[model samples]
Target: MADVVNSRSRSSSPSSLGATEFKFPEGLVAHRENLPAGRVTATTLDGTLTKAPLQLIEDLSNGCGGQLWPAGIRLAKYFISRYRNGDELTGKRVIELGSGGGVTGLAIGLELDQIGGDIDEGGCEFWMTDMQAMMELMEKNVSFNGLQERIRCGLLDWADPLPEFVARRPVDIVLAADCVYFEPAFPLLEKTLCDIAGPDTEVLFCFKKRRRADMRFIKSIRKRFVMTEIKDEIYARESIYL
Candidate 1:
């Protein structure tokens, strides 16, 4: 993730034109006033951790209206639960693409941590990517959970080339949640997957079956990828790579 620090020091005068600062000793940040009213926990490379209340706004200028999808959340929870005890992706390099709220990436990191994995000890690394605006929230969420050292955030537009931005790393797993809604972007998403994924790489995608166009897009991609349903909850489909 791009490193940009926006904080106010305690020693600064109250009259300073800035918001109050709340810092996590582990490197996470939470503004209770901005977060939704509910229990929010994020699974990290260490363990499941409670989320701090903080407001997250979408960058409308970048084509994101800052909406959080329930289907994405469900898929993330499912991945954590299914792999929480299994050998899949344990201590491996992983990346989440188009991570609007970064729920899955955060959860995967936490689940590994909870299972006594070595990510917290620096044995693993997580890369979370999205547009610049959403990337901001992804960074805040990682810092909020004090997983700064384990998780890295970046801006990855699937419309662009992967080699240009992300260094060539043998990513073991790739994840995408609710990123296939737009018809025009489907080709780019497929191309991006082809560019970044290898034969041994596993890719997981979560999508809502609400739109007919979405179904069509999935059908087109199925010819190239072996897709298996991992969960079939209402309005969502969670699939694992072949």
Candidate 2:
């Protein structure tokens, strides 16, 4: 999946943004006779933890949200790395926006379980949300991984009002990955962020830059939230070792 995305990022441009053209390669069946369940394994946390084999049903027949994208993979791993032993996330209320496959939210639960934390008792209260289009597959993944107790799924169009369950309490964190695609959604997403997150809510947004237009989304959000780039450690030697 990462290879396919890297190839697209290298080949595509704003004028020829084939974001919706992404699909499984011809004859490369995701499901075979041996694995008749039509599911695939995505090793999160660098293979330290494996999510239950997710049912691979990429309904690109409708839209691109059904497939797992690379940015979501990166964000999921980042959450796993940041929340080890559940120190910072023990009881915080978290909400993952554009949670296509619930990877990041599931990774948080898996990480809690990895470090001897009880997801049913000590895990962070988390909600994974996306537009109505992606609800079925997203909900299936949550149940497939046995995360019903730790995470909830809902329909969350950024332009619409916040769901009643989420608005009941102050959100502590907002997680989004690869959500900046269409230009029209920029303001809607920005508004949703401001509405859901309070002054203290931590927003972890991750996206691979596919076009200069992607900058527009950043510009709109900057007015409401102070932004900082998290540089890779290997490339930040001067800043780290200085």
Candidate 3:
């Protein structure tokens, strides 16, 4: 998988991205493979977000997104490193596309909570979106984090028009993780990303390349948006590969 933050796509130097403290069942090796099927419950982004860890439940009954993936962890940590105290996201409209278990967005809420008072008052609105099938798991995780009041979960099919909640205002930041896996859905993802991301919007896209076709999805969007790969500071980029 890869981590790309699209802000008009410049192929400059790989920016340094620090890692966060996390507790995984199988450590970093989990990303090289998929977890055994059934259900998984664990706390991720353990130390950084809050005193109580961000707990998540992974149920693959709906789709692969039901489980946590490398890009989600990387993107969440990268976001935390940059906006750990939650000041940058203040007043920004952030949305995570294809948020299977709402891991990334929920982790974000934990940071935004650092601002104190109601997160809504901070003018920072967060929406974790995915297909209808993933809503239950998403909502469950939101409740897991005690973030019901901080986040909103919605149905956002990439092939469909922007949901009313997202269409109502300008989306300042877009967080997408592991969205490039299925080649058949490339056009749909492209349309939706380009549709929602304005000239000034920031898009954080992270994915692990399961196949060469995933690069095709990347190329399709390069024409419209520049993709800059994030350089991981803790481990070599190759470490993410199996």
Candidate 4:
């Protein structure tokens, strides 16, 4: 089986922010690594005026998924470039797994809202989930962007059972970025994916290769699901490989 690998071209330093709160550096500076607690403003998708200024508190003092990673940015771009308006997302149940800072899901919510509609009339609903520790920042991001009604934030630890609210219905799309590190969590992640994903469900993962151990994580999931890479012409030349 082909190992799942997705990459995006990296950019410059993009002007570092102080250890406290900071907004995302403006312009084409898309990638920022290990920023301490800060607020970041980024486009919801590509070639669109919609912007989501997310308030993120990254406590490096915390363990994995604390800071925003580059793959999240790339995945946001992919959503913007691909799912314009709510056409693709309309009537679908969307969820972002391991949603650090809630950027990807928030972006989608913004786009869906902009496209405009009530849930009964083809509008989509979103769920942003992570460990309990990340709830504050996730909720802050959801509220920061005025998406409370459209997006719901929840505690979703991979090792635990899926919340009743989440498993009550089928999920159409699962968005995950920079979530496949830490060797010990591999089985937990795989089991969670299997539990949530149906045969027809689509899971879009955006991540740069980090270590050889990542392959082990991918190998574990391949037994249950087929993984594929999507190449976007808009970001093809700009993508940086891990």
Candidate 5:
């Protein structure tokens, strides 16, 4: 909802020396590249909660969905921060939409296994879904993190009907990041969310504010869902980014 960020300058007091260095959100690390295709390796993710580093191979030849994004990193870190409580993602069915690099989904699966959380049937069921073009990248990342058994990479088109993998079972949570960049895909994304997100479903979506059209997508989602802003240090600092 924040498109314009106010720029204010004020004198800092002599005692305002407690400011800390800015860093990416906790439980989040990404190695990106400018090349058309490359590998990304992140070794540390907020300590013991992460047993191993996550590696994602991005192939831009496929599409924009081949690279990582800030929203996905933030979502992964935020969700891991919350899941460490041991109650989250327990036997829950989670689907991440528009998973470009599959960072968020891969990280969740990694952390769940690191902490010995349930990932088998009757446990947390996680699926990383995107358009057909992103299926290969999604699968590679899942295998890179040794989570092939834990995470399922599915082809999900926003404009198409609900896939059997999704329609067969009710989704408990829907995770999306950087899914609002394309103007033409707005209605398709909206339709998918409405179809999958029942009254009991929870959607934790994060996106960078880029244009006026982004606000329109938010407004449309609000018409069907009770959307709320999650106040945090990361959300506050990143909200102003264009």
Candidate 6:
């Protein structure tokens, strides 16, 4: 299994403040509306190369428009860098949990095609999953990147049973970025991971490493999985070995 690593950085602005107080069913708090513009390179199934404009956040309630978080962009770039450097994930079956904007998983799918992998030839599958609302935006992002066929979107709440999804096939790798927040969801996340992770599976989790609550949750998970510090600088992201 390939080792998952992370890097962390503090947000210069106070945009993250509203995220803490908001709950899912209650709806997210409204903050800034500025969407950062950036270019993301995505590879298609035919080995064709293309670039797409990326946004920080996509509001599910208001037609997928919102500020794109900086952490998300960083995570996406990290995945692209790893995939480009010959990571084992090039053509492997991949599932991404908590795919906020679907950047990480989309990056993997794009890189796979660029490296001349076999997904287009029906050799692999990429599953991008998140909550129902997030999944809607994820699908839009997948379609926007022209990867509708190479990527599949679904709703996968870690707190619930995903027996039918797991029955499809054993996943080679599972990834999540900036997903650790709620204290109650930590154990459910672990249980979900345990359900999908085998001896040969690799899981990559990235977080900003802020807040005592987040740190405590990560510590608890470390007891169950082998935690490796990939890059322990500003954005403290780490990889988990099962």
Best by lDDT: 5
The candidates, ranked best first by lDDT, are 5, 3, 4, 2, 1, 6
Cα error, residue 82 of model 2, in Å, equals: 0.8
- Candidate 1 ranges with C-alpha deviation above 4 Å: 1-65, 86-88, 114-122, 163-167, 233-242
- Per residue, candidate 5 scores C-alpha lDDT tens digits across 1-242 of 21111111121221212322234442222233453464343433335235665555656778777765667766787788777765666677888899987877877778765322245545777889999988887887777667777788888899899999899878888999889889999999999999999879999998877789998989888999988887676565665221
lDDT of 3 by residue, 74-153 (tens): 67878877886537767778888999987688777776554223345775778899999999889877876678787888
Residue-level lDDT of model 6, residues 84-177, one tens digit each, is 6444554567777887666566656665554323554645567788776566667766766567777777778887888476547777878777
In model 6, what lDDT does residue 71 have? 42
What is each predicted model's overall lDDT from 0 to 1?
Answer: 0.56, 0.62, 0.69, 0.64, 0.70, 0.55
TM-score leader? 5
Off by over 4 Å in 2: 1-41, 48-57, 114-123, 233-242
Write the residue-wise lDDT of candidate 2 on 99-191 in tens digits. 875656666665565322233565567788998878887776666566667678888999899989779888888889878878888888888
- Per model, state how many residue pairs clash: 16, 0, 5, 5, 1, 10
The digit string of per-residue lDDT tens for model 1 on 1-242 reads 11112233222121222333332322122112243322233222222322322222222233441334444455566666676565655566677788875666665565455322354453555688987666665676666555567677877888777844354667777878778778899899998888888788888887654467888888887898887866453332223211
Q: Cα RMSD (Å) per model?
A: 9.2, 10.1, 10.2, 8.0, 10.8, 10.7
Lowest lDDT block of 10, candidate 2: 5-14
Evaluation by lDDT, superior candidate among 4 and 5: 5
Provide the lowest-lDDT 10-residue window in model 3.
4-13
Instruction: List residue ranges in candidate 4 displaced over 4 A.
Output: 1-57, 114-119, 232-242
What local lDDT does model 3 show for residue 151?
86
Query: Which order, best to worst by TM-score?
Result: 5, 3, 4, 2, 6, 1
Error of 5 at 52 (Å): 0.9
Between candidates 3 and 6, the TM-score winner: 3
- Full-model lDDT, candidate 3: 0.69
Better model by lDDT: candidate 1 vs candidate 4: 4
The pairs that clash in candidate 4 are: 8-239, 8-240, 9-238, 9-239, 9-240
